[model samples]
Target chain A: MGVRVQEGDFDLAVELADFGRGAGGIVTFTGVARNNDAGNLQYMEIEHYPAMTQSAIEAIANEARSRWDLCDLLIIHRHGRLAPGARIMMVATASAHRADAFAAAEFLMDYLKSRAPFWKKEVTSDSAEWVAAKEADEKALDRW
Target chain B: MIDVVYFAWVRERIGLPRESVETDATTVAELIDELSKREERYALAFSDRGAIRAAVDQTLVDLDAPLKGAREVAFFPPMTGG
Candidate 1:
């Protein structure tokens, strides 16, 4: 039952430790802003259909559960305006073993990147553009 | 009745982000046809059907998939989530 939409930054170490209660291992991943300096991105805005966004995230969480034996999971993604060096999303997983925890965390991120409904719009100095879906993201999901 | 939603470029193309419509269709494709008839904006939004993707009841679905009891439907471009 760990789903959150927040504007503030998150601490992955704290979240992983908290979810690790009663578990043998905990793994976490945080997606940070990249320096697409060539793109000249001054800022980015993420927008989503509220209800659909939540449902899609939950579905991804359920898919992770089916693929791995886990104790608990957490996901938090920020929306609205964001700048370079800002955190975009985080995933934390706890499991009976380190392998399961690590794999599940990776799986969750791959799925979230491809399947979730969020869209990103980049505001550059010269112009604004909508981010396009990458073929790599689709291929990432096919591995699972 | 189902609430159909659009987002990002799809919303811009269709001139709206959401709408409620009553439909008798049993599949998402059929629903798209019904919506395309409503206005030019919808027609353009759905013109390149291959570029559009759909979800029924919050689950990603193929266009031919049945919408027998779906309460909500969404149409958008291929996901750019990250």
Candidate 2:
């Protein structure tokens, strides 16, 4: 379980340089900050419960590894102010088969999106609002 | 005294991120009731309890959940993480 909650940017190349040695398949997902349809976004600020963030990610990663025969998993989520096109976070999973890797990656993504104790607030020149939890996101968990 | 904390608009409405709360409330819901009676902002923040989520000692819990010797309590809206 390699879960990092940081304010600094991470190097994808360096992170995956030796991600999974024996695993035949590897899947990755990256989320980047973007603008809303109404305005030009200045930045996004992510706030997370410091005490629970790490343990929550570790629990999710552990659950994914248990259900799938995953070799390794990595989760990195960034906080503080981030500009548009800046990376918000990334998730990677590795397994012996493509299906396991893909499934585990999606599982981690869904759980992180809905259950993690992090919140996002989008700031524009005119207004700022906390990003609300989408109904679809909560429904996405039904598949798991 | 429990260290109560708020996040996002919950904090904005209450105008504080954290505070030392003196209380005899045995459950999270009771704590909310106590706080809401103290100020209008707390009432506004806890008005829509369905939209709020509680955490005791950093673990997510329901409002009906017991305090259970908790050192910290957090209240926030449903998460929007990725």
Best by TM-score: 2
Global CA lDDT of candidate 1, please? 0.85
Interface RMSD of each: 1.1, 0.7
Under CAPRI classification, how is model 1 graded? medium
* CA shift of A27, model 1, Å: 1.8
Candidate 2 deviant stretches above 4 angstroms: none
RMSD to the true structure for each prediction, in A, is 2.1, 0.9
Error of 1 at B47 (Å): 2.2
* Model 2, position A45: C-alpha lDDT score: 93
Q: TM-score, chain A, per candidate?
A: 0.91, 0.97
Task: Pull out the clashing pairs in model 1.
Answer: none
Predicted structure with the largest DockQ when compared to the true one? 2
Residue A120 lDDT (model 2):
96
What are the per-residue Cα lDDT tens digits for candidate 2 across B11-77? 9999999999999999999999999999999999999998998889988898999997999999999
C-alpha lDDT of residue B46 in model 1: 94
Error of 2 at B58 (Å): 0.9
